[model samples]
Structure formats: C-alpha cells, structure tokens
Target: MTEQTSLWQDETQSADFAELCSALYEREIAQLANADIQSPQVIQGRLKSLPYYIKRTAHLMLQTQTPLDLDVQNASWSAKQAAHMPLSGQEIAEVNKWYLAQTLTHGLVVPVATTTHIVLDSIDRIDQQNHRFRTNVHGWFYLNDTEQKDKKVNANYRLLKPNKRVMTAACTGHCWVNDHKTNPVIPSLRELLLSCAINWRNFKQPVIF
Candidate 1:
C-alpha cells in the first residue's frame, strides 16, 4: 500500500487525515474565491463546479477503498471507520477553520430565486429604527424599522412576532426579504453562526452540535 493509503488505514493517524482534508478544502476555497472572474456567468459556473471538486478532493485525500465515481450523480465515499474517530484539539481547530471558510463561501455565493418560509422565534429590539430577530431554521436577521412610530413599529413587530412565519428570499449584501411589504432584514453572520450552534470565538474546541 502507498504511504498515504497506509496513513488512511492507521487509526492513530486519523487526526492527520482530518488535518489533510481540512487543508485541501481550504486551498480549494481560496482558489475559488481568489479567481479573477469577469462576469456573473463565470461565477455561477464556478459555483456549479464546486461540488464535484469537493467530492474528488475528499476521495483523493482520504484514499478510500472505493474511489468516488464523479460520473455517478449520487456516488459517495468516506474514510474508513476512522471518520468517526475523535479529532485532536488541534484537529478540531483546523476543522472549525474549514467550517468557517465554508460558511463565508456560502455567504459569497449569488442568491438564487428560491425563497424559504421561516418562523420567528425571538426578537431583540435594538432601538427605535433597528431590531434583530431569530428564526427557527434560518438564523438571526437584522430588521431595520425606519418607521419610528410606536403604532407602526408595533404593527411591524406583530408581523414578525414570535410564532409568526414569513416567506424570505436570500439576497446579496446579506439581506433577506419577506413577502410582506415590511423593510428588508439583513442577516447577521455572527449571530447566524451562533444560531447554527457554531461559536466563532472558541475554535480551539470541538463543536458539540
């Protein structure tokens, strides 16, 4: 077996495998982000190609028994039982960095036409003109309440009151819009990460969620 293949089979080297995969993933993200794309079509094409690149990179880095067949739409591969092996402290940190990069990439991608219905779970009234709210699925949104009147503000609050849901479209500039005529809500990336159970502050530890 090749040295890399042996490394994959060695349970003790699981951390090393995780580190390698994380590095490769980071490199791919960097290359994609730094590319000089002159047009929207080019950007879309690159985004479309990311999945295949990820699959191929994982298979090559893991040296799995069954190589990932890119031709098959649903083919999948994973590192042997070692995939479930607990990662070391450093490995966890490296993995978290990769996760953060992935999230940032998601934020950078152009918004699609699809819209989702999200139920508001809670709200934090920031001030007269701005507020923040959390959703059950999508995460936190920053609502700009330009209308300062208490009656109008209360009406807007009622529109997004807890337990009330609305149709939302993800847009550029981290902005999300509801089907209702209310002002557009911008997503707070930090709070959004927290809502997803990822704490950006403690990258040194493994994420329990």
Candidate 2:
C-alpha cells in the first residue's frame, strides 16, 4: 500500500500559505481602529526615514491595496544597503508568493522553560559578548520589506549584529560588512534581527510615535 505525503509536498500546501499570509496581513490591518493598538492609519502618518528607523521603532504603516506594511527606509539608506542591497516590494512579493506556496515546518517549541518578555514601543539592540556564548538578545520584546531606488530600497532591517565590533573607522565607506577586512573574519557568527510595531491607540498623540 502507498501512503500519501503532506499536501505541502504536493504544492497545495504552498498555495494555502500564500492565501494564509494574505489573510493574516488583512487581519492585522482590519483590527486597526483609531482607538486600536496597531492602527494602520496612524502608523502611516508617522512615517520617517526608512531601514534603521523602521527597525528601532514600533511604526507600521497601513497599506490601502495590500495588507502589507509600507516598505520603509530612511530618507537615506545606511552603508549596508549600498553594499548588501536589500529587497524591494516586487522582489518580496515574488518571494512571498513562492514561500507561501510551500509547506514547511520551521522551529517549534515543546513547552520547555522559556524567557518572559514585555512589549515595548521603543526597543534597543545592545551587543554583548563573552568567552563562552556571545548573544544579541531582544529583551522585554523581540520580533519586512518595501521599495524605491532614489535612496536605497525602503528596507526594514535591524542591527542584525553589533556593528561596533565590525568597526568601520578605517574602512572604505564606514560599512561594516563590506569595508572592514577584519570584519570579514569572525568566529561562529550569529546575526539576528528584531522589530516591533506599536499600537497606535497607545501613543497616538505623541510626536515620537
């Protein structure tokens, strides 16, 4: 007797995923009331420089056509953008289309002892290293893409890893990944990125939010 494999392996699972992602995006947007925590409209108004600002801040812009948040980058992209060159919307959509169309299970939990966390509208990434295990932890909180060319694409990225250690002081253009020769050399490197989107209802009137 032949047994059937998972639908994801059959392609239907991936198709379902695209639909699921679209639905999730909508659910996030639909909950946006002016009084809601994650109001889409309020987020759009608070737009600022893209990329870094997008990462360190809890700002998420609402889109009219699609459920995706606005592709945000600074008025100017940081050096990383010029070197690595982040993704654009069309590119992302294409990826999402492929990803959502697939069925795969990634990291899962089995109810072991886990760290507790709080939700902060403003978050910070600090680099701490020791002889044993070096970690960039997203404490109290932990947690996308967008387009344009005039500046670097409105990439939403975080301090994936600590940049200070990478030290761009003597580099070609103050770029960590690209400039520093020593940066190219590292041991057991683990880079993690995190972001947060504030509930508009919480800090609506504030200039910062």
Q: Pick the candidate with the highest lDDT.
A: 1
Residue-level lDDT of model 1, residues 1-209, one tens digit each, is 69978877685446544554455456556766888878989888866876565544444434422222221121221111211111123232342234334322112211112232222222222122234333333343333333223323321222221110111122111222443333333332222222223222432221232
Q: In model 1, where is the ten-residue run with the lowest total lDDT?
A: 163-172
TM-score (C-alpha, index-matched) for candidate 2: 0.19
Candidate 2: give the clashing pairs.
Answer: 14-101, 14-102, 37-199, 37-200, 49-74, 50-73, 50-74, 51-73, 71-146
- lDDT tens string, model 2, 131-174? 01112332211111222122242132321211211211111112
Q: Where does candidate 1 stray beyond 4 Å?
A: 1-17, 64-209
RMSD of each: 16.3, 22.4
Q: Ten consecutive residues with minimal summed lDDT in candidate 2?
A: 108-117
Candidate 1: count of backbone clashes, pairs at least 3 residues apart or interchain: 0
TM-score (C-alpha) between model 1 and the true structure: 0.22
lDDT of 2: 0.24
Per-model TM against the reference: 0.22, 0.19
- CA displacement after TM-score superposition, residue 192 of candidate 2 (Å): 17
